[model samples]
Target chain A: MNLWRLPRLRAGALAVWRRNILVWRKLFVPALLMNFGEPVLYLLGLGFGLGHFVGDMSGMPYLAFLASGIIASSAMTTASFEGMYSVFTRMVPQKTYEAILATPLEVDDILAGEMLWCATKSLFSGIAILAVATLLGVVAGWQALWVLPVVFLIGLCFAGPAMIMSSLASNYDFFNYYFVLVITPMFILCGVFYPISTLPAVAQGAVQLLPLTHAVMLTRSLVAGAELTQPVLHITVLAVYAAISYYIAVILVRRKLLV
Target chain B: MWFPPDWPGLSHSNFNRHAITFYNAGSMDTVENEVMAADAPTIRARGLCKQFADRKAVDGIDFDVYPGKCFGFVGPNGAGKTTTLRMAMGLTPLSGGTLTVFGQSIADHASAVRRRVGIVPQADNLDPDFSVEENLYIYASFFALPRAQVEARIDALLAFMSLGDRRRAKTTTLSGGMQRRLTIARALINAPELIVLDEPTTGLDPQARHVIWGRLNELKSRGKTLLLTTHYMEEAERLCDELIIMDHGRILAQGPPRELIERHVEPEVIEVRGEEGAALQELVASSGCRQERMDTSLYCYSRDAAPLIESLKGLHGLKFVHRPTGLEDVFLRLTGRELRDQ
Candidate 1:
């Protein structure tokens, strides 16, 4: 019942994380397609097809502009889907968490394991897109290696809040409302496809409040070799959102399942 | 409750606790547990309570479970049996009062406590993705057990549960009985001192139930403590050394199954079915014996059924059955014959 009380976590959380890795390895083929295929399509189909007529965006070629945006967008969806759909299946119908709870692991350990696994999948999507975009000769530098750690942070940034949504969901259909209402809208508005400056003043202000806005600003800055307006501020905001949402999500899930 | 045809001397008072055929004091896995059984209680609860929005599931009950004894919680469905077990395992937080395991508070030392204990939950929650042996390996990994040691234990446990042939089979492909046996094997993977099972054989066929019962008795004979809940009076009568009959989140009675039956019911009972006869009913009521009436059956209990039978001798179409009273008669008498949670 204590909102601020930190759950006593242990290193055993990694056991749960390892379990997921084994399952992912078992289903390697489809998982690889899902993680890598869609973003590649969006990049090549939209980047080359749409980049043909349109020339440059923000002093960069249209293909280069969309590449970093695709990394941020794809990372967001991959992490969010893991936190929502996969986590929901394990938590509810599969009853996996309940089995874990019977052992030495606490509910906190299970949630931490789920969050780490979600972030890992997100990191996979981000790295795959970045690799393809580099081979296309659209963007490359030693500076892009720094994008790996930042993309991992971006995965973590979206994971906690997406799990909060997962803790709220009752079934798979509930995630549609989340994607349509929250995720897809954030995808379009967070400067992923173009600059946020083109939007109306109030809409731009509202977009600034979204988590993906900060995520895209950080990864895109590192990917496109552009100077960020305030790098520390964006990173801090994402980290704070991740922390606060994570705390609230733990409490909410405890209420939902442990009652 | 099944007795083999060869063991005619096995009575309720001296079943298998002494001179067990399969298990003996010399063969106990750990001698430390045999000594620990003398002093400290394995589980203790005081003024325990669990409250929902408007009702309490476990309403302020006190009990103690000593080591080397099979204690039972017997109640109808929705009588808070599972809730109480969940609290002990630290899966659910107690709304009020104190519960301790192995002399440590469950709330404060849950992980340390759970590390030594094993749980067989009410439902089958085996991982569908893993093989039988893989399931055992994955579960053992939680305890951080050494791989080499666990590999040997898994092989022995598979054979113990008669799952050796199904080591590589998917959990989903096993029959219900095999799945139940696998779950029991999984629970014993760590060789825990205390095992808590909730309705272990609820949905199984009679043969599966008998198999699990035999395994549980073997564990008990080896001096592993057991705490279980069941609506089957026969299960409680056979497995538990002491049991409590619970209803509506409260215990109605607690003692050895034989002692509880004796305390709550007469030793012999006569049942009369068919025919509505005010004359026969009045004769039995005036004869000073206990009586319970259902739709068409009227049960009369006394030290002797001869007088009651002699009085109702000529009642037309009325059938009579005389037999020794058992734990089911006491359970029905204490809890009453009514559909709970309706």
Candidate 2:
């Protein structure tokens, strides 16, 4: 492919973003109340209410620590929601990919467009949760600004592999196994609500293998204004995963669309 | 004014004024007319072929589609008609040969070629998410047309397809015929020079098919090129300037429908449906008409059918009808009755 094709890819990406915005506008209010409300309720009930006995966690306020974890987890959730559900439906049930391929656009354009759309959704969802966390006085300093971009990167990282899975999935029932076996375990073991060190040494090592673990760790470090030393390592790990996953997604899309 | 020798109105002038005016007018007319008359073929294909694994779908075929002509591809199922059309539009890769639209190869200039061609697929692939008018607008946007121009074209195409009243209705809400019409309107949004329809009226009722044919004819009158694939012989007869009959990935025949029928089938055909196998054969042989017998029917080919009918009158359990030969007869004569599983 020529480097000059970047403009076309960018245009396609923008088009997908516009389509996502349309879908969001139609389903936004209900989705926001559910996604935002559930986490906030968790914060109020578990963070504040339980903090009276548990006190500070890992030398930080329980609410702040918990808030950062929620932001990271929700970023993954948002990207996965769009990538696994909406993207899968469009690829299979809706047959949208078949229609798009009939145009002058190619498979690479479709993959880039979909990945960008997933990233945008994750970014918005992450920001919404972050703002709520601020109202509760959990965030600190300018590091919060970095949270947005990192969340976007994290969302993109998951989106690439998730899209590949979506393309391969045979039916909606297959997604159930994916969520139950892969996603649920990652959420529990990735230090989303508690420190991973509390788990057994083997379990802690297993958590490190997950992309979400690096994302949650990096996001928590940034939101709480902690030292930046280990955050760089986390960012590197996430970036590697994202690049590899994206390449796989592009290949799968090409095979499916062109063939 | 002084009288001049053999000069009427120009007698008073030193120069012949009409000659100068005529010369200048004729020169300008020729210059303007030359450019307009030089328009070339809008689509051309040479030795185009497509193969799938072990089988060839479309094999080395060549043709030129002049502007404003309704070109038809007539073939039975699995004859490579759709595959050929798809290759022409760059929707499918060509296994061999080349196709050019507006004098440019599709491989080298896809975007430019696609901008001038619109396609209606055999299956309905309408965007179920958008309303009727929105579907047109979004498709136009892919061509990067201006928003104002897109909206204007959407309105015009909707009115042209008689879907103005249902512009805002979701695609799922529309009837099958309505959806097909909307798909046609969508194809016209960019003012394509050539429109390719793959089985456009396959499942439509007779009334709807006629309506679609009317729309296609209207487009033809406006000087738009149409390339369509259909199994309906009557449609090809009614709409096409010329067509090709294909089978087993090869062109069996190509010409005007009537000419193909005349060339391949006799002037009249006597169809015999009965159990009098030996008697029917004897009648055909004695009547001097060439005959072919299938499992259920006997076809007797001749210029005059009355003699064949009279010869067959004594055959027991014989029922027959005589009719003028048609494209169907030509098709049956060439391809036979073997079923092709696509």
Candidate 3:
């Protein structure tokens, strides 16, 4: 009758993470192709095509301006897809979660492992974009190395909410709405393509409220070698997302996996 | 690493606190001595209940599975067999009452309890992406087993399950029987003191079923405790030393297979199937042979079958089969012939 029991996180989650990695390794090439393909196309198409007209935005070429946003959004998309689509497949269609539950691993362990894998996959996509942008001479200095850990934190932020969605998913069809409504809007409105300043004053305020916007702000400032005015606030917002969503994900996934 | 000194179900065995050592702490001779020396059951359920919204999946069932023995939950589909097995493994939470594994309350220390127990679920949920050996390796990691130790055991387990030939094969490519065997091998990675198999051979062919049954018997002889659930009467009769027959989420009968069969069913059974089944039923009735009818067949049970067979032979156009009565009759008598679906 007690339905509000919180999950207990334990060391067993690493095993679940290890299992996903073992399986993911078998198809690394295809995964890498998917991870790198989209961001590269966006960087080339949008940065070059759009940069032709938008010459300089507050002091930098549009390409450099867009590179950091690409890194942040890549982390968001990779972690979101990994958490929503991949985790759903493993939980429902494959029944992999049930198999893991049969062992000593609890549901919290399973969720933690999933989030870790999502973050790992995010690192793959984010670092790939960072490498490509660095080759194009968009990265200002070694201070841009700080973006790696930030990307991972962004991954955790988006993966948490995505896992919450996955816990409620009954079938693959449920994800279409999530992608179209939630993820697509974040991709376009979170300063990924253009500065929030271009939008109306109220719309800029709204954009700042999105987690991706905060990630983009940190990634852009750090990658541009520009001094951040409110670095702690940006990091605090993303950290809050990561922490709160993780707790919610654990509770939701436990209800889904345990009966 | 602390085990409660007064663990409820272990009855003063001198095994180490770590459950992993419970299986390997002593030799076969020592295990046999302990099996005889130990008085407590490895698993015990007292009025355990599991309610899902409105339905009672496991309704206040009580039973004990002794050490170094095979215990079975036998019932037809949706008879709560799987639920009871899940409850025992702590996979499903008990809605009411007490259930313990390794003498420890599962709700209080599920991970510790699960550390000493292995489970083969009703469906084979093997990682389709991994090869047979890789599946075993990853599963071993959940128990925190050392790489060298699990690697050594993986070789023996693969051979024992007759899966050595397919060690490198993708789990998806394996046959149903092979997948089932691989699952069993994966469950053994921890060298668990108790193994719970939920319908271990539900869908296998006769040969595959017999092969699995043989391996399960071998495990038992080596002093491992086993808990399994199945609807197959023959499987229950062959594999279980003690069992409980369940239906509608309740235990309807409990005893050893042979004892329950003797108690419920007559020693003999004769089947009459033909256009003349009614006449055969009448003859069986007049001869005082207990009989039940289904569709176009009549089942007659009696203390002896010679008279029943003799009476059936004179009835033209009627075919009859005479055989010894077994657990199936007991199951039918207790759970009935009505279809059960959930």
Candidate 4:
């Protein structure tokens, strides 16, 4: 990339990151702690406590399996929170996007900056959760390092769709329908807590269509030191979905903000 | 022509020296004979129009905003003043005709045109997440100014707008007037050649409005051009070097304030307040002056008001007063008294 274009995108992204960090600093410390602490409590309370009952499933420790699933889930959750909730509020309620666009920054710069910011936040939260899981003896080997890139891919996939949903959503109430119908089903039925193969054949086929299921399977297999087979297929499917969702999001934001 | 002889007050040497000086001054004048031409106008609009569905928000309108002049657009609500101004800044697309800023078409070179113009929208659009200084610095960054230059400009603007004390305050914490001033300050971050204001003093108090007017005059002294849309007649009269009175998306009249009032209205106006009946109409018909009826008041326009007032003195239940006609009377006459569907 040309040096001039790089700074344009980098400056826009850094400005957004700095602004969000300032806001996060002003939020109550307890609120910030709770947001980071919830998943750790889940890891211990569910991964270890529940693993005691179902030990050594799928030839891997139950705690290890659950830890991988938590990392993928954390990536999606953090990206979704930033891409959907915060972006929507800034677009409609706060009118922050209007204020920014009034400057010389183009729509492409703003969208790219926002996506990068969401990815950064999700990556930070994912690594923190992964580090905590390692200390708890849940992650097994150096193979866990692969989870970082996988979590980043998951964040990108979720961010694209979340941005589109945010642009279409008219009010906070409209988000409830999306949360109940799309997000909740993906979390529960996509094998976050159990293997998809354990479910019926029909359920397994249905879970295969979801982005989260592919992410969870990839993260879990990588963390368990399992042999990699046809991994390119998983990566290809995610890349295609992310590309199409991003195209749609960019068009929608341009129509909504620029017009 | 023969030169006149020296007068008693001057000696012959003095006369000769004065003649030589005059001849040298005339020769230097020919050497520097090129006239200082006026700078080109900053904004030129011709037949600009905008339509929303079936309603024409801006009809065909033509005007020019010159450099270093405070140009005012005055009209009642829904007069297309803001629509026209937005089109000039390339914020809103024109339905028809051409608008050029700094000699470039708004359609073909919108970003380039926007680079030379600053806008203060009718409503405050400050970023809530950033502090006052951050808001200004971010705007400067949009123009791709260097970090050091942006910081210097931010400091200068903050002090100029009297906002140094509120540099760290969030936008939501500022008062209405403070926010308005901050918006103006943000517009100046880029140091644009032309600054467009859309009803900048709509809700400000008298004191705040005066402060803004004073700053605008200072900007004018520094050779900055201003295009403002306002409904306050007094504001138009006070600050505008030249003005356009618009109604129904068309220019009703345009000139200096005094010239516009002189052309469109009379030098003096006698206002009569009474119920309109046969007697009032008969009195007005026989008054022998240019007259217009608005609601319950009859405005008789003339260079002299005493004759009209003397004729109405004996009328019953009538209150009459004489005052100078102004831009408001011109606007009401051109746009009429009917409420517009804004």
Candidate number of the best lDDT: 3
What do the candidate models score in CA lDDT, each in turn? Answer: 0.83, 0.78, 0.84, 0.77
Write the residue-wise lDDT of candidate 1 on B36-138 in tens digits: 3434568988888999887889998887776778889999887888989988987778999899899889987878888988899899899998899989998
Clashing pairs in 1: none
**Candidate 4 chain A lowest-lDDT run of ten:** A1-10
Every model's TM-score: 0.90, 0.85, 0.92, 0.84
What's model 1's lDDT at B171?
98
Off by over 4 Å in 2: A1-8, A44-54, A141-143, A197-209, A230-240, B1-41, B274-278, B293-295, B310-319
Query: For candidate 4, lDDT tens digit of each residue in B1-342?
Result: 224323324433455455555556556544222111222357878889898776888889988776778999999898888888767866556789988788778775666676677888888888887899978876776677788888888889889889999999998999888999999999988888898899989999999998898888898889899999999998898889888888878888887888778777778888887667787678777777788877778888887778667767777767888898988888787778776676
Better of 1 and 4 by DockQ: 1
Estimate, for each residue in B1-342, the C-alpha lDDT of model 2 and write its tens digit: 221223211221223343344345567666434322343456778888888888999888987676778888988898899888877876666788878888788776765677787888888788777888877766665666789988888888888899989989999999889999998888888888899999999999998899999999999999889999999988998899778888877889877787888789889998887556665566688888878877888888998888777777766667888899888888888888777677
How many Å off is the CA of B110 in candidate 4? 3.3
Q: Return the candidate ranking by TM-score, descending.
A: 3, 1, 2, 4
lDDT of 3: 0.84
TM-score between predicted and true chain B, model 2: 0.85
DockQ ranking from best to worst? Answer: 3, 1, 2, 4
Return the lDDT, model 2, position B139.
Answer: 69
* TM-score of chain B in each prediction: 0.85, 0.85, 0.88, 0.82
The two-chain DockQ for each candidate, comma-separated, is 0.63, 0.24, 0.67, 0.20
